[model samples]
Target: MNDGTQVHLRLVRPDDKKLLEQGLARMSPESRYFRFFSAKDRLTHAELAYLTELDGENHLAIGAARYLEDGTELGLGIARFIRLRERPEVAEAAITVIDEAQGLGLGKLLLTMLVLAARERGITRFQCDFLARNKGMHTLIERIADDVRYGHESGVMQAEFALEGPEGLYRALAGVARKEGHVRPGSGLPKLETTNDS
Candidate 1:
């Protein structure tokens, strides 16, 4: 069990479907809209199945889990990239953190891990879509990704960015605090920590 503030990052598993659902339930309606781009309150059976299934290379996902003293686990955040079949080198990335965990640097940490994971599988470009009002996310993308380009359509903002080489990624990781959390379930990327001051 963690000390409540500690978040354990690991590869997503099929069994995490329930935890993910619970995390969604805890989100505010606004938060839900921010992540899903709609007022979606529930995950359909098909949606759950799709979210839980991961192929590592094409549909890779990582979860940030917080454990209580009683051995209960809660899904604090998730970051994933799904490679397009038509463009194997490109992937769309998405991340969502529970409201309780927001502003604690969890989203940044998860995104950093996702970038490393995607680069490991030969993914070169990452795309993301969000509402134009979500300035926090925009700032985050600007901070981490290189060669970023933005597009706007009907109030929605889309960003595409290229992943940097190993040296840059390693430098970013090294700048973070190593004691905050650990990315696990096996990672080929450098093991640098991201600040998680929760």
Candidate 2:
């Protein structure tokens, strides 16, 4: 983060439903709107289940949390991708960062990790849909995707891009992570857990 906060990245588990709910409550209305594309006050039981209970191969989610001095972890952000059944090589990706953590490059870190996970699962392309007013998401995608094709419909913008090519998506994300100070000298990207370990 720009503020030098050390955030831990890990795979989300079923036990994290409450943590995710609390994180959603902590987000501002604008942040919620930008993320969910709606002014939702709470997540339903089914939605919570869908978000937390993930099969590492198809529906993968990575969570970010900052640990306080007292060892209490605060949820900061999440990035996930759900593989398209129709197109096994493609997936829909989404990321959400809390309002307080916005603009600190946490999103980019989460995205970089997510892309790595996606590649490991054999996903070669990513499709994203966001509100037209979500300029932050647009800018982030623009920075990482080389051949991004965009389409607009009913105030929503949909984008699709390949994950592998001459200009590797992973390389682009690594570059952004370095520029944002998330990558430390002599240290590679953070390790991501593939299991649902609590």
Report, for every candidate in turn, its global Cα lDDT versus the true structure.
0.79, 0.82
lDDT of 1: 0.79
lDDT, candidate 1, 111-190, per-residue tens: 88788777768988999998999887898898787789999999899999988756565545635424444553243224
lDDT of 1 at 94: 90
Judging by lDDT against the true structure, name the best candidate.
2
- TM-score for each model: 0.86, 0.85
**Candidate 2 local lDDT, 1-198, one digit each (tens):** 778887766778898999899999999999899888889999999999999999888998988887678987699999999999999999999999999999998887887778877887799999999999999999888876788999999999999998865436565555555454444443323333312222
Off by over 4 Å in 2: 165-198
Please give the TM-score that candidate 1 achieves against the real structure. Answer: 0.86
Candidate 1: pairs in clash? none
